[model samples]
Target: MPGEDMAGGAADTGPEEWADARLRGGADAQAAQDPPETVRHTGPPAPGMVINARYELVAPVGHGGMGEVWKAYDTKLRRFVALKGLLDRNAMTGASQAEAMARARREAQAIAKIEHPNVVTVHDQVETDSQVWIVMKLLDARSLAEVLRSEETLTVPRAARIGLQILQGLRAVHAADVVHRDVKPHNVVVGEDGQAILVDFGIATFDGALAVTQAGAVIGTPEYLAPELFDSSAHGPRTATPASDLWALGVTLYEMTEGRTPFPGPNAWEVQVTIDTSPVPPFQYAGPLAPVIEGLLTRDPRQRLNAPEAEAMLQRLLDPRAAIAPTPSAPPPEPDPVPVRRRAPRGRRAGALALGAVLLAGAGWFALPLPGDDPDEKDGKRAGSGGSGTRERWKDTHPLLKIGVKDDQPGLSKFDPKTRTYAGYDIDLAYEIAERMGYARDEVDFTTVATDYRSTALKVKLVDLVIASYSITEERKTAPPTGYSVDFAGPYFEASRGFLVREKSSRYDIEDTSDLQTLQVEVCTARDSTYEKWLPEAGFKLVESPPNTYQDCLDKLLDRSSDIYAVATDDVILAGYVKENPGKVRQLENVGGAEGYGVGMRPKSPLLKSEVCASLKDIMSGQVWEDLYRKNLSPLTDRKNPPGLPDLTECEVQSAGP
Candidate 1:
């Protein structure tokens, strides 16, 4: 039914009509008084025909398989509106008449509940003269089907703009618990002002409504159906979800840009088979928008890009700076390789050790200074060496750059004992910044730091930089007596605060912090960390004694005897724990506000902090940041929609001084 010529109007085949009839009632029913052949060939309604004493039909505009649309004047509202009624009920059996009426009522109900600018507005629904009619707002617009038939294709920017508006409308529909199963070019109308409005929700599914069609009956246009709706064995059942609508939207976008759907065939069955077995064809004209299309076209619904992620990508395409740049014919030469050097071990423990060792060794290490500490030293060799000093002096005095990091977090930062090397997102980022600052790879030292000691380690000059998933906060930036007085550079990574619970706790349906409070679940978080302050603010019940590190909280969660039901921290940190434990734990993301992880430094190193901030900005703007994320966190997190690069406006302000 979907692959038919839809340039003029929708034309349902015999099977689709029969499926609709079965949805209303059985096929054994009386026929209309008029003969079927006579009703099928009846002339259009006259231009001056009046309907329901409130509408005057001006002219017939279009005809569909089940109904016909008319440009009519609403006398009661003193405006013009689109009127739709059964094309010819007398031409079919009694069951077909009932099916057409039911479809009209369902369409009216679905569109009336959604009041977005991009969605069509419904005025009223009435039954008169043995015909069901729906009244809706009229526009000087044409269906996208007609436009596509004439123009063949559209520019990428224009298509993206239209796709974005449709996505917004779909989001509102989903928020109301409705799914538009029929989202194709035929259902979209583009006005003279270039505003795209989604119309025709005739086959939409409401949350609590009964099934409109019987089991195993194909509902949507075959060319636009999602992969899951084709074969129940390969990908789940044929049940429709919001993601199904997104998949249809992806097909529509592909058609708009390429002048044809990705899976093309001579017939509907062939198209369905191709969609089930073939990958999306490579793009020829879709340059920057290719990724968005690929994200939507992912066969797995779980990994496909959601509405918000798709909308963000479309918005980025609208930005002028996001235009594609021309590539050079020759490849750029690679940089000279930096020599490797064995790292000298500091007194602090490495993060690759056992959790018990971390809990015991990291408890009171921050209270005492390192063995070679000298309070009066200002030559940049010991603790507080560069206090209130110049960048040139600090760089000249320190031959090797020392960076404080966490070793236990699997994806963010982890230490491998077998290879005796540090690897993960933060590790790669540390190397990126160091290279940008004129330091060789072997000239850098990574020392494991506990969560609560990040700022103190920077203030005491235990390390030149702290990249241990350290969050930027006002309390940490303020001078001593009130706060830690630590300086922060770029917020290189953006993550949300969330909860990590054992898989068994999923039965509680704990979606957010409020759910945890209502369930009286005891939560555990690292002491002196940001979650320590946020947990009480969120009204969560904390354990009698909090853990000293994230791993300690995770340990408590793994122990059956412990009272901890969930571990609270940034989602990035929780992702690591989930990856390590596998099916044992899962993260509940976005339970709290977003937290930006920054590079922490001593407050006195202003010039050096500025340099690091600039380096971070460069890394985010290039492909290096995305490559690092894919290598480390993408497997554990949402690979289709990774976190966006954070805005570094604060870095500019900090660099300009107070």
Candidate 2:
């Protein structure tokens, strides 16, 4: 209802209105503290004042946790525009100011490129009397938040219509590879002309970009948050897919129809609890529209109804279709329960051993996980909840800790099928972790995992941990957190992504090809790299290939099939291959990307994450981390200025809250 809040709350900087508080517990409570009529009015540009010489502010429209929304007139265009500016811009300094500026820039960048009939349009971002302002499309219509606030609830057909329109905007947003992280009712504007527009790209996440969030929490409204978001269990990287946004859409529909939040609670944390553990309550008023709501609200992201699917269902409601499922003659057979199997790894290189640099603390050195245990919960309560749980029984049942590593990665993990042995930086670190667990090198089991399949292995309990060069991203962390059931630890190493080309091929070199928009070169990269998704959008003629492994991409370049290979992955990986191939391949020093290597684990292993995080921090800060780098990666990397590892603080479990 207030102006699109990309900058954080008054207390902190980030998209505050719904960004930080919805993820942690801020906005609503913070707003309640301040009276509704409160206007920051800290400095210049009072009502009717002109800003940036062109826009004349008619009046202050609304004020909330984020900033202030102003109704203004664009003098040049002779049309109205919403001049959104920060309330406390003139009064802030230090980190807060820097954070606000970053959020503002991010919002402008995110929305400026998008053009959809159902999305709010951004005209320009300008500096007005020392305060930054974003000029956006003005809508005289009431927000969906206001609509509900005025008339408690809407009929099923009306709710369905609004949802369908929202889905149309979402289709365009996701098509542009953006995840509208915040999708609450307040952000949706419904015009009097019957047009519904999805507004606020302030917290939307694009590929390779991290959403600025409250330091220890997810960044979205907890009530509308998908169950996958409440996943502290899988302490790994979080990713929010299209289904996540759809889940919020489902929540919005429910709220519109029922006049209340589907998962209602006084606090964000309590809302998360209900979403994670509770089943969907029957919507008495839903009638024929019940199926759409239930399908979209499914807990498991994998099984949840997607945007297109929900769109079709809502479309059917808007324009009734003849399609209907006939009643089954008999009850369907129950799906076989998936068994959690923990076993001693198969196909071991017998007698292969590693030495733990030190002895473990004691029998309790390993993590003891309490399933569904909230990080904020007391230890005593967790201890008494589950008797001899899986974490507790890990040692007794499975003697060795099963760790998954990549089969072909050079510097990270390289498995030798002939010798049945594993080597490289990841292997060494796994041994280091195992030693800390009071086990011999052979006591830990090693399993081969493909890059894309690692999440599955961890989810199914096929592996206890993954030490591959996995880049810990916001998307990976939140992508169906509860459903995937995995955790992450230690960014023990930091690498940069760069381009590799033949030494003589000046045309494919980074220096030779500056402008991507006008460039004429073919680019090939590994299938799993994020660059594969965003590169074409940036104007690169990508070479598609079957089985896009790092080796495959390299082979394509060597075979003269592709002019260049662009992988936003480990620089050391490219370095190793380049060195081995001599003058044939060279890395483009200018093309660089950040790639932090973190270890992956399964859900319900917060203690494991905590323990691994400590080890990773030690490996990152202490001499052991350096020694491993020198021994395994230094020969191929830039030894003089080796890349520094990322801060493991982000991976640390926040027992308190975001």
Each prediction's TM-score against the native? 0.48, 0.45
Per residue, candidate 1 scores C-alpha lDDT tens digits across 1-658 of 1221111122121233322332344332112111122121134566656677667666566665545677765655545677777334545466665665565566566657887877777788876645767777775667888778887776656677778778888888887888888889888887655677777665677765556556766777777887777767765777888888999999989888777889877655787789767888755445446656776786766445667556645654554212112121221222123221112234322321233233323432111122233221433233233356744433455556778888779889887766657889999999999988888888787766677656655543556899988888888788545235777887888888889988875346666667788998988998668888788877888776565478889998888777788999988889788888988888875664888888988775655676687789889999999899998999878675567888875587643231
Best of the candidates, lDDT: 1
lDDT score of residue 371 within candidate 1: 23
Let me know the TM-score candidate 1 reaches against the reference structure: 0.48
Please name the candidate that would achieve the greatest TM-score relative to the true structure.
Answer: 1
Tens digits of per-residue lDDT, candidate 2, 456-506, equal 556534457888777777667776443453456756777776666666654
Please provide the root mean square deviation of candidate 1 (C-alpha atoms, Å): 22.1
Mark the regions of model 1 whose C-alpha exceeds 4 Å error after superposition: 1-49, 86-107, 129-132, 320-658
Task: Give the per-residue Cα lDDT of candidate 2 at 343.
Answer: 18
